[model samples]
Target: MAGHTSKRTVGALPDTTAESPFVPVALTWLAWVLFAASVAALAVRVLFGGDWAIPGVVAVDGLTVLMWVVVTFFSGIVHSYSRRYVAGTAHETRFFVLVFGFTVTVMGLVAADHLALFGLLWLSMGLLMAKLIGLARGWRQARAAARVARRHFAASSGLLAVALAALWWETGATTVSGIAAAADTPGGSVWLVAAGALVLAAMIQSALIPFHTWLLSSMTAPTPASALMHAGFVNAGGILLTRFAPVVTVDSALMLAVVAVGGASAIGGKLLKSVRTDIKAKLGCSTVGQMGFMIMQVGLGFFGAAITHLILHGFYKAYQFLSSGERVEHTAPDGGTGATIGRVASVGGVVVTLLTGLAGGALFAVLTGKGLRVDSGLLLTFFVAFTTLHAARDAVQQTSLPAAARYAAVPVAFLPAIVVYAVVYEGVSALLTVEPVSTELTVLHVVIAAVFVGIYVGIETGVHENSRRLYVALLNAGQPSSDTVMTATEEYNEY
Candidate 1:
């Protein structure tokens, strides 16, 4: 049998000549209005250092303002892009409404001071997103994907409800700040259960491994919707943990569990991503990995670092999804001939990564006149090491430069990257007033980092001969069951 073909093109440029141009123009203007408000809110926070409150229900702090700025800025971009991308689609107006509603709910979620209000907005946002995912009315795959996402998200909502009820019952608090203040007074068992529930909710929302199928399936949605989902909504888990940091951080057991799940998801997602043939699916898997890293930062009690990672990853994923249509296939170098160079590059890259991280941490310490905290410094170092090494390996593989020049230049490139990362790390930490929780490194952190480095090196250096088998397994791991697709398709056809 021939493969099924989509009647609707995935990223085709829609004709605006026949359509009312006001739809996009109006949406774009609305997005910018929200963007301007976010900026004003941020400015007020920076200048006053006081929160703007809406009586007893909402409060806008630096974090809230910052996320507002982020969500609006990205949503504005996606809205404008969609002007041309989905201009003439049958559901263009409906698409705009869904996007606008989702954006507003997210902004509300960030600004919500009251826990009940936040929960309401959170559930609303999930519902809007599900509608957006299934917007491609007749597409069976799209409907199936939406069903998968809704099922997982509904489970997440239930967990969140339980957590919120527990928190409210224990602390007798209605607002986030109030809850945080009262959190310290709660007994150990109650706090532990609440924190555990929060972590599980985060895992489901962020699509951490085992709960990650929805993300992979969600690729059937349009690019703009996918972009917004990844960039704006997926980070809710990190935001949730950060917002409730005072409460969540008190439980060491919960923190360790977060780390364990995050570490597993990070490695697993990357493994799956490397093997995926579809570009959007690859991006989805990558989002899973990035969210894992973000959650890992939260687990390490580096809420500031987690926020930074969330923002950075959100922007990166948005850009990746928006530009996914322009992707071109590139053949990798012949492994036989490139193997030696790749191996050397991998080792050299690791050294450069370590040196860069050390230098960066030292500089940050010197400038701030504070000693480096072991956990935060190590977490930062792990990221810098892994990313820089991966980039170095890829660059060496692709470049035709002489071995001498390539080897010489790799280390030289590390100085600027390290300096920039160090500066940003310090800046964010100061701006957020994040203090290091521990001066000593834990065994778990060390083991996780080592395992990550080992896996990365094995992949980069072609040391693992069974990589092909592993990749195949990962690919199979991500595939939806045929029953799911067929059932959804049959149901849709009947309609």
Candidate 2:
């Protein structure tokens, strides 16, 4: 574990392509806009049923758009910070191009309603993310990350293929809707088994818990990639579950299994988050936890919660990963007043919100006997408590240490907005039976707040000493310029 520091400096953002200008920034933004439009269309479809109303596929598209928007924002921040951090570099062009390519494939994946279309897009995204990792960091370990990604992609492909084969055997068709809709009338068992197997594939991609090593290895990528993969790409698995809700809801045992995996990952993520020292690693674990929450929502038949969590977690995590310590400014010891009533109110508001969720979930669980006690709601409670305490403690310690220019106001200012938003969102969700309130949704809203608190704590405790060390590590993670693929491919052609 790395030591926590109050004063840290992020490396300057790299602009590797200023001279070459290979990929135009305008084109990048254009791609982002199209992606955003696609996402908005999907969200509208989710809100109101559409022509091609495959809810799961629609949800994926919507979430992809939202995640891409998040990445766009992060890219802007990274660009701004890099002016001072990275200065000048030749690889930035390649970096952005690969990033754009990666996101484009992800968009295609979201829009894919057919099984074959999905497989193509999914594999493409994996390839592009791996390529971007190597381009951005040039790390010796980038090759390792790429290897893990390939294994994951292959496993996913195999699972999907098995599902398809089973479908063909059962009903002589591989279409997602066709397999299930016709399953009961004729030979359905193959379709059921195939669907079950595909669910496992989704789990692998989601990085729930046991299959989380690929995600950990991916942390070696640049911050933009980390934010995109963790917050955006990883959510695809949950989106897949939501996409196949028709099949999932019918099988009680399968739904329960999904719930089980989601619960375990949520709990596991919160626990792992406590002990992690690497900044991005902590965020990655949180990504796992958030995915758990999304999966639980899908498993429990709460589509709204799944989308809402995806949108909220995606933006914040991306921002936190990219911006990090960039916003901090060292201040005099007596620059600001000590903790105020507002901070207290903010913390108190968070606690109250969490308690409200737990009470709601507990009541629902007792009355309906539907969900597990260890699902997303319970994990969210733990997240809130853990993050709030850590953030407040870090804030206090940083101020007292007189290390960096204390920008206490930055975090402190957000308190009122969070409290107000939580109150309104929860109150309204309760009032409207249309979007039935659940322990899971309540849990998500609070956890989003907790994410903010976690970032504050990470910045305060990490930016001082650890952040600089992190920068050094990140810079060193890049591979040497001369170590291109051609050189390695030729040298190891035998293997």
Which predicted model would earn the best TM-score? 1
TM-scores, each model vs. reference: 0.87, 0.62
Q: Model 2: per-residue lDDT, tens digit, 129-242?
A: 767555544355566567776777678768867766776676665455554466455445665687687788787888877777677667546666676676677777766665
RMSD of each: 4.5, 10.4
Instruction: Give per-residue CA lDDT, model 1, range 1-495, as digits (tens).
Output: 146566774664556545556766788789999999889877877777877788669977777888999999999988888887777667878888889888999999988988889889888888888888778877776777778888888888888888888888888888888887786677677777878888888888888888888777776677999999899788999989888888787867667777778888887787777666678878988888889898987887777778878888888899999999889555564556333224444555456545544654455455544344555455655565556656665555546786557666765776566566556656566556335454246787678778877876676556653566765677788775342343443454311
Misplaced by over 4 Å in model 2 are 1-22, 39-49, 52-87, 136-138, 183-189, 326-495
lDDT of 1 at 320: 96
- Per-residue lDDT of 156 in model 2: 73
Q: Top lDDT: which candidate number?
A: 1
